[model samples]
Target: MFGPRRAVFLDRDGVLVVPQFREGRSFAPTTLAEFAIYPDAPSCVARLKEAGFFTVVVSNQPDVGAGRTAREIVDEMSLRLRHAMPLDAIKICCHTSQCACRKPQPGMLLEAARELKLDLKESFMVGDRGSDIEAGAAAGCRTVFIDLGYTAEPPPERPNKIVGSFREAADWILSLPQEDS
Candidate 1:
């Protein structure tokens, strides 16, 4: 019998979309106009899917909870993302405070694994933030950290791999040895 399916968990901002930067900190786009998906994002997701890995997006969008952005706008952005990529699932946590589903807690990744019937040990998490790396590690997934060189936020301590762009991240994942079916 086959075990649970493997997945690639991606952080929404910086990994797939061009994040808005203010005071050297990365932030999710509040308006649709500011939300721009990376040109390579769609193709990379397609490659992962074709490789038999579920492409899932796990993101933390705290702006909505902070009242800086409306939930409707966030939902619209999510809809646009779904239209742009062939993702298996997109899980988002909009909490401003420490919550079960927030990054660095691994709740989102764990929840996705349960709902998607994925194997956490066989999955990979790609992100550009420390919280993302921490979450992936807590969930027992290998991590890829995209180093965008943000000045305000320090780089994560350790990631399974580090790269410069989403394309590179995808390439690294593709280069890994696959387990026999």
Candidate 2:
């Protein structure tokens, strides 16, 4: 149960990866060779960890559902990230349905709460898309958006906060009253 308020949800693609260019209807990095992490993300997560926030990755990987990517590849990507940065957990919603685990849904965050014993109110979700924000807000956590300009349309629902980069969002969090803690 997410009780005493302790957790942060993150998205992997645009928020973490630098995001290679795509023509249309596709922009995700197609290979492990292409995956890259943001420079300041590690320190940002470290700060949250120092502040008693269990950082978890809440992502939607429908590639498995549609057969564009394999489950093992995605798992490897997550593990590669684990080696690259220190995160409490990496959660993925492989289903293509309106499943609760998807970004537009709160399933992954809720699942993280169940597994990690988080406090939803104290947690935050940082991602690069509107669904990422919606999921966090629906789960009752503050949301942050890292814009990559891939989204072709406006957000149907907005997040609690928006920032140009993860470091900016991290700086904003650090400026908060709880930063020093």
Candidate 3:
């Protein structure tokens, strides 16, 4: 019999893709033309999947909810990402307000856990923002923060590890000891 599955929840912008930076802050690309995945992302995700971890993307694309960007464009970017990598799923929250599915709340992770039969305790969340860390921490998973040195505030909840790139994060996660069944 198999035990519960482990996962790595990745934040879309900054973690997997390059985010637009201006005035010392990070921003998601509003257009597909501006959207581009980090060169190392696909291989890093492949490494995690090879190590028996499910790779899921949990993102907050508020531009959609705010009507600044069309939902179809975001969907297209997701579809492109799926074609480029071996992701198990992508969970996006387009709400601009304080909603349950948004990060800092853990709704997306929790819902993924329930639907994917994931073992939260053994899972990990990798992101470049405070809310991502908070969400992972709240969902009972170890968090990895990719310190891009954005002008925004640091994660209020400490992450298990801090890395400079997705490659480093993947290496750190792979270095952990495996749990016995």
TM-score of each model, in listed order: 0.97, 0.89, 0.96
Error of 2 at 77 (Å): 0.8
Query: Considering summed lDDT, which 10 consecutive residues are worst modelled in model 2?
Result: 21-30
Q: What's model 2's overall lDDT?
A: 0.78
All candidates' lDDT scores? 0.92, 0.78, 0.93
Which tens-of-lDDT digit does each residue in 1-181 have in candidate 3? 1655999999999999999998776899999999999999999999998888999999999999999999999999999999989999999999999999999899999999999999999999999999999999999999999999877665446789998999999999999997643
In candidate 3, the residue pairs with backbone N, CA or C atoms under 3 Å apart (3 or more residues apart, or in different chains) clash, namely none
In lDDT terms, which candidate is top? 3
* Residue range 28-101, candidate 1, lDDT tens digits: 99898999999999999999988889988999999999999999998888899899999888898999999989
Question: For model 1, how many clashes?
Answer: 0
Model 2, residue pairs in steric clash? 2-118, 100-107
